[model samples]
Target chain A: MPPTEDPDAISKTPPEPPAPLAFDRPAFHQQAAPEFACALCGAGLTGQYYQANGAPVCSDCRWKAEHESGPPQAGRVGRFGKAALYGLGAAAAGTLVYFLVLWGTGYEIGLIAILVGWMVGKAVFSGSGGVGGRAYQLLAMGLTYVSICASYAPMVVQGLREAQAAETTAGAGAPEGADAAQGSSSVTRSGSTESFVRMAPNGEPDSQPLTQEEMQAALPLPDDPEQMQPGQTYKVDLASSEEELSPALSLVVFTVVVAVIALAAPFLGGLENIFGLFIIAFGLFEAWKHAARPAILFEGPFSAGAAEATRAPALPEAAEAHGE
Target chain B: MASSADVRSPAPGASHCPACGCESPAARLLCPRCGALLHRRRLEELAAQATQAEAADRWGEAAGLWREALALLPPGSQQHQDVGRRAAEAARKAPASLLDQPPGGAGKMPKILGSLGAVGVALWKLKFVAVFLLTKAKFLLLGLSKGGTLLTMLLSFGVYWAAFGWWFAAGLVISIYIHEMGHVAALRRLGVKASAPMFVPGLGAVIRLREAPADSLEDAEVGLAGPIWGLGAAAACWAVFLATGSGAWGAIAKLGAWINLFNLLPFWQLDGARGFRALDRQQRWLAAAFVVCAFVLSGEGMLLLIAAVGAWNAWRSDATTPNWRILATYLGLIAALSWLAVRVVPMPT
Candidate 1:
């Protein structure tokens, strides 16, 4: 006589399909269950019982059921598809916002990138009925990386455009009768913001040099400027201001740092960048292990947990019986 | 009739109700601690009662009913947070008449305290929670996340670089990271679960042990491992200095060695205290004497105080016996490192 079926005792009993492998206890006890009692624990209910698994369950049991039991098994593939779609949508929106911020402020908001990753992970993992696997993790990582790259794309384009513009301007303004490449003086400014302008051998000013007071006021100097050299000319150009130089400089630096971290991590040895590369590797591993799992974020009944626990223990026994 | 019966007979298996912190789980549907219903049926009943109470301008009663409803539902579920917000709102909008009204039996002191308590709890739950919770989140990132920890350290390194030059900042952070990794390595060897090193911005990097070490000896070994590796890193920096004769590298080496030696000072939450705890009374006294002498030699007041406090803690602690051989070896190594660090490293004036 098997535990599941007592053939000798009940010849006329109505046949029923086997209980689900994941949640078997409810199906097994439903026949002998007391009406108006908790479905999972069989505790007598004082007030109305919560509806679960087509039966009434006590509040404690209901909470368990909602929390621990996986969502409905039906339409899982459909839910996964929907989750992927939602993740892609979130990634796209996040990337758009990231790029907008970068363009407007000329600063990379790393926090936004992290938020995008978290949001995409949440959206996809939750959308798939909270089912997590390697496939989901890969999808999430891919989406997140793509979104980050999308945000960086505009800055890259802008940087190249600026560089080209600067080159063209330098070429167009170069003096003739001398080698334009060599004769072209690249005026490098120091911390003082004073550019060392190269005059031609004949000594001709390209434009009128501003007075000392005008030079002091125009360039936004710190308090207590030094007395100017009486004979030296001071030039101030509105178009070639420090403020104009900042965006291009920041964009370049940001791009280079990000590129170095991304491209050079694996190759860098010793203490140089091993920690950074290690961090990335560990993150990816954790993302696969944790972020890939569909988190049961929205609270559910506790009965779900009890039911799931029972099913988990029953699995080995079920497997043994099946093998026998 | 059912409610009366529920009061007479408690439910089994629950044994304790989580919501009201009640030991006796009286009635499957109701919690005895707060007399709040635990069932879904009570949701509507509480809501209806709250609505009626609100209609009568009994805001306090209305808030209580709403709070009960909120607790019954799973937290963060759409309905739960909504009810929580409504309950808080109702509690806030209590009429001036009700706010001033004294309890039936309690004196003015009790009433004042009660009002103060209610206001405090509400303020704590609302505004203070949002910011304080982020602080907890910061710890969570530092403690649990490897990537977050690394990033945080890097960010802090960047900040340090702004104040000090890049060379010094980079050297220090790397040395600290190596020290933290030494602890991590020790933990791994002992088969304890631990996280990678996490760095607080202004403070230093720390490795969080997920599980406690097996015994005092294990703890001490883990503690000593950090400074040991740190000494090695400092030595490497010193070697670089010797080769290149760069003042910056020499300074880095001196700073690294000094920091590691400082970490050896036994104080609350310091590695030295952990290692000291494993030593016997005699050894502990010896360690203290050595520290005092070192402080006297170095003329560092902070070090002397930290050593005194750590020694006292060690003397008082009744920890498990440590492996004598390992302890002796640790002592020798530490003494050598401390002596060499102070005596050897050249500090460019």
Candidate 2:
């Protein structure tokens, strides 16, 4: 009889080594069956069951346990569209809050606007609850820009109106003092939120000395001695030809520059919003990172003897062939 | 097989034990005889007997004795590995008749090839990940370090200008560059090895320290240097504003002061936290008060973030022992910055 027929010798032979384990770790084995639920998903494992981490696991969960990276994400388009809408809502809300702050404080708080961008990112990511791609990031940024423009519109419109009014009043030959005083007063009074600082003619811009005739014409001295002291020094505005000649060129340049700036404000803003958008993207990336589920683990249930049977070559057949 | 001699302990009157030659009394569970653990001594004796058997070419006896020695030693320890290796060697070299196996085996090539194939497949599967890691390492280890500091600064300036506008971006880049240079200068003065400033595109500049600070005080000095230099640059900007009477220069000066002050906020990875290492508990409280007041007066949302981060750090930094002299210097600097801020935006000229 073959050595296999001898039960004693068969029992004495060592079990085949466990199959080379994945992740370069030692093999796992199950000693006995469990009378409880699946360790991975808490499902009631009935009849034949797989062992995972020394506990019973259902076949479905067993597959997931073997594949540790979790399942591929589902529904890319739907999630991103929802995220975009949420970002839009956040942007609108942020801008409204920014404008309110600007109104209350009489100063544009840019850092607060950046906070809005961050919040918009957080809101959008949470609303979607999925990994976002580049397109989704772009969409968030686009909405941020919309918010920035919307907030700045009221301020920009006010600045434009004041600039136009100042130009017309200057055209109407308002005294240099009146024009300078009025422009400065309007800027300070309106509380324009544009951070665009313009180089307007501050104070009196190095005026030429006035003639006695021009001084008399400029300010009519009060006849009463009580109202005006005889020794009081008086300064007058002079319409110098040289000053007028230079102003035409300077005014043209100034107007052109201001107009160019007014036109390019939105473009420059869009550029800055790129950085803001990048910030929002970073926040969204962080939010999206947490959406992945942890991987489950599975252990095999085969006895040591059974495991040996699976791994060993067909020994009886090979031995018979060798005997032949 | 343990004989009577091997099992027996030395007599109490014996001056010294034979095994380790330690003088001790006999008839103890532990080694009053040799100062060796009784159980451990037996294992060691067994190992010695195994070595003798192996020298005498008694393979089976050596293998069995080595196995006993292995069981007594900690798993994965040097002794365990040595004993296990000797046992395996004895088993392999045992006579074919005793081992019940054919000698001079030659059929292992297929198994060896199978292992090689498995390794190849693993490498193939991990190719993408390997390439990705290699690329990242290349950028970090080689790319940034290759260029001169000035070139890197220029590149950083270009990036900043592209991101922020020319008017705002230039001043900001110069300000940040100056700040990082301050760190480099402080590091040099303290005889610490450090690299020149390297600027990140959207973020600011940083100087890589080749060596760590000698102590918290040294660290505070290195940290304090950045803001001091920055404050100087800002003061210079204020001077330009004074000379030119340009509102743009005034704005830049104000921004410089505000940024330097903000960097003084005590928080992780900020200049403030490192500088805060120099402060005692009272000074920390004073610094906190100052930051709070500055935030309230500034209405800057960035300051709010800094304060939040700073407060969190302060809560967590209980382990740091403070240096009072550094605190006084830091406070003096803060006072100077405050004065500069007032001068920079002195009521509307």
Best by DockQ: 2
Kindly give the stretch of ten consecutive residues in candidate 1 chain B with the minimal lDDT sum.
Answer: B1-10
List where candidate 2 sits over 4 angstroms from the true fold. A1-118, A130-139, A157-265, A268-324, B1-148, B156-174, B185-196, B200-203, B207-222, B233-255, B265-269, B273-285, B292-330, B344-349
Q: What is the DockQ of each candidate?
A: 0.01, 0.02
Write candidate 1's Cα lDDT for A1-324 as tens digits: 656866776877777632212211111211222233555687755533444323445677645644455445577678778878988997888877666655543445444555576777777777665666567788777776666556545545576678778765664442332332233332322222343233333444223333334333433222332433333343434345645547889888877766545443334444454333333343334334444543322211223212111111233443453332
Summed backbone clashes in each candidate are: 13, 1
Determine the C-alpha RMSD for candidate 1 after optimal superposition of all C-alphas.
28.1
What are the TM-scores, per candidate, against the unseen true structure?
0.33, 0.40
lDDT of candidate 2 over B218-281, digit per residue (tens): 6788899889878878888888888988766777777777678767767546688888876665
In model 1, the runs with Cα more than 4 Å from the true position are A1-324, B1-146, B297-303, B320-322, B343-349
**Which candidate number maximizes TM-score?**
2
RMSD in Å for all candidates: 28.1, 27.5
Could you give candidate 2's per-residue lDDT for residues A18-80 as a string of tens digits? 221111111112112112455657775444345433344567765544443322356666777
